[model samples]
Target: MINTYPLLRPLLFSMDPEAAHDFSFAQLDRLERCGLLSRFIDKPLIKPVHVCGIAFRNPVGLAAGLDKDGKHIDALATLGFGFLEIGTVTPKAQSGNPKPRMFRLPEANALINRMGFNNDGVDACVERVRRSRFYQEGGVIGLNIGKNASTTLEDANQDYVMCMKAVYPVASYITANISSPNTKNLRDLQGETLLRQLLSALHQARIALSDQYGVRKPLFLKIAPDLQANDFKFIADLLLEFEIDAVIATNTTISRVDVATLPHGNEAGGLSGSPVLNSSNQAIHHLFQSLQNRVPIIGVGGIQSGNDVRQKIDAGASLVQLYTGLIYKGPQLIRDCVRVFN
Candidate 1:
């Protein structure tokens, strides 16, 4: 299937990342409608495992920023993910940064996008989720929440809280995004002091909601790849202290040290692709090693095959995920990893 997908790559790769994303989703939607998505796809290994107190059919998941608005949840589930995370949705809608915000470094198998949390907001995402039948059929889905693009870092708490409240009813889990480099001052929330404050607020919200609604759901943190050892240590400590349920070990890297020779080396935004593999793994290892498996880590960077999935699990990721890998390797990548897991 990977080989077959490569046939389409020439055409898909010819377009911008954002355009290609739409094209792929549209194709997936068509496949699902025709009941032929699974024909090209292999049967997923349905071995279920418990993580974050939720059951997943497999450990491989679709990372956020791919299906940012929960638009094609059913189509995504058909691709064989144990779970699909959507959004970075905020309290209100915004147009994001600008056109040409997404760049492709095909030679490096990477993408650099300054798409500042663009989405139709939390309500719209929820409507899409509510309308999605995939969740009714045992698909695990995560909601990645964020502050509105117009909001300030100091006031990000309100935005996150609102999204949490709005999406909690439908999401299997929640990921608080504090690490998108494109949003101005957003990463600042990752600071020791700010992180503590934000996590505390979100935790309180989680507890209050759980008690009030009598429903218990996982709340994880989506951190940045740009942190130092000190930052990692502090974050791990904070997670333990705050009882943060899980951690998405990275978002993307703002640094471009590895792709220096590439023509688009100095491009802005976070770099996610083969170049991020080492840094992300190191961060995952640092967290996994320091945390000592106290919390589960979802490692998602530069993964394109079964071996990459194995490496992430070996390093300490309880579950693995991808975005760039799916683009470069195609849909067969999911079945390949599930084959390994089985």
Candidate 2:
């Protein structure tokens, strides 16, 4: 396999961050369609592990945000992730925050994005997932759902319930994402009172959906990296109490301590990459201690190498995810992570 991203990095880096993102996925899709990608990349090696009752081919997955609407499942699958999580799709599609929403801090090997969960609505995302080869192959596909930016906080659960019902029949797992820092007041859902209410509604809905579809899908919660120890303890207890299947220990951090001096370090959005490695690991360790193995953890943030993935596993993650790493290191990072298990 040609694993050299160095030859291609400068061209991609020259474009605007969001433009580069779109161009890459589009090209990947084209390569996949033309049957050219397979010639350069083999299927990832098997390193099977079970988390949240789903059997994953490996412990490395492509995280949410990168493919927000589930539009690139087949193309992304070509790169060999054990699984792919798509969306933060909302009940209704709303254009996210204004332009210039994504920024790269190459100096810090990081990115800051406040995409605001902009997507083509839950129905559109569901249709794309249903049409994907990845979904048809019975590959593990996690659909990450969120409330609309326009939805009032008081009525957020409705959006979640609606999306859960729509995706339940097609998803290997469902992620209720309340952690993205870009959304106005979205993190408020992480509070004990609101989170309990949201989880209870979704739990009941999941049971009903399982009975109806004759299939049960695991549910996960994606949370932020910024939280006090007490807050994490409370959230962990809530997960056990609600019987939520797993937790993706962190979306992105609003903190910029590590990259504060770098260009775009002060950008208004969540910071992700090497800067978040320690905080994400700390969150996983804390959640593991609090959950006591009753719930699984999908650790992400600042994962750029096999060692970074291993550190997450050592902390308490049953599986790990990548986003910024892939941007910084290319598809080779996925193989690097899987090789760690080998």
Candidate 3:
């Protein structure tokens, strides 16, 4: 099939970035309902890999933040991702930062969004996931949970615990998102002392939830890319100490060095897409070395092509995910990455 996104990009680009996002998904949902989505894209290649005790059909996954509420799991699944991670969801619903929270840097193939953990909340997301064909058919679904914007840093652990317990039964894996730059001081959770406390609480909660559900779900941590050089080893030690299953190496970066001169380059939010590729890859390499293969790394950031996928794997990522790349390259990017793994 001829890739049609290039032709369609102009229309979407003309609209507001956030509006374009909603419109794109709305259209995708329509096409999926009509069962015509596959007519425009090739099926993703099957190249199975077992990571963190889950058998993935391929290494390419739709990263968190794309479908924040898990509302389009079935539609996205049809496009053929090995996994789908939805949320950054919190204990309560939020409107996110505000209008114009998301911005596009077309020149840099990047985006800057301070869309604070905006979602339909955990309950709504859980219900949506429950109704999805993907979940019912045993597809890999990771629930990435975060604290409510209103939740205080001191009370953050409770929010995370609540979300974990609620999603534990449904989540193929659960990620504690402590790295979003958009959230005020959320990254403080990454501090050594605070991180230890949070991980310990989560470890205990996971133990109980594991016994309660009669199955143990892997717990993953997502960290920011803008960390000091020595942080990786310390974080790796904690993961080993707490028996955490995996780490999503690097979230959106707070650094704007790469896009400072571009339009919307100075936006006050986490920078993602091509600008983040190098930093995130460096984070993965650091984590990989510190982890020594004991813990798996899920590489995500600025993955726009099959070669980018190879770079992540070479850097020691057992798996990789796509978000911004999808916006620029469209669904064809999924198949492209999958073929690289094959």
Off by over 4 Å in 2: none
- Model 2 C-alpha lDDT per residue in residues 1-342, reported as the tens digit of each score: 667687888999999999999999898999899999877777777899887779999989999999999889998888989999998899988889998999999998999998888898999999999999989988999999999888899999999999999998889999999999998999999999999999999999998998999988899999999988889999998999888999999889999889888888899999999999999999999999998899999999999999998999899998999999999999989999998874
Tell me the number of clashing residue pairs for each predicted model.
Answer: 0, 0, 0
What is the model-wide C-alpha lDDT for candidate 1?
0.88
After superposition, candidate 3 runs with Cα above 4 Å error: none
lDDT of each: 0.88, 0.92, 0.92
Deviation from native of the Cα of residue 122 in model 3, angstroms: 0.1
Q: Give the per-residue Cα lDDT of candidate 1 at 194.
A: 94
Alpha-carbon shift of residue 256 in model 3 (angstroms) = 0.9
Superior by TM-score: candidate 1 or candidate 3: 3
Cα error, candidate 1, residue 104 (Å): 1.3
**Least accurate 10 contiguous residues by lDDT in model 1:** 333-342
195-293 in candidate 1: lDDT tens per residue?
999999998999998997799889999998889987888999999988888999788899888877787777789899888888888889899978998
Sort all candidates by lDDT, best to worst.
Answer: 3, 2, 1
Better of 1 and 2 by TM-score: 2
How big is the positional error of residue 236 in model 2, measured in Å on the Cα after superposition?
1.1
In model 2, the clashing pairs are none
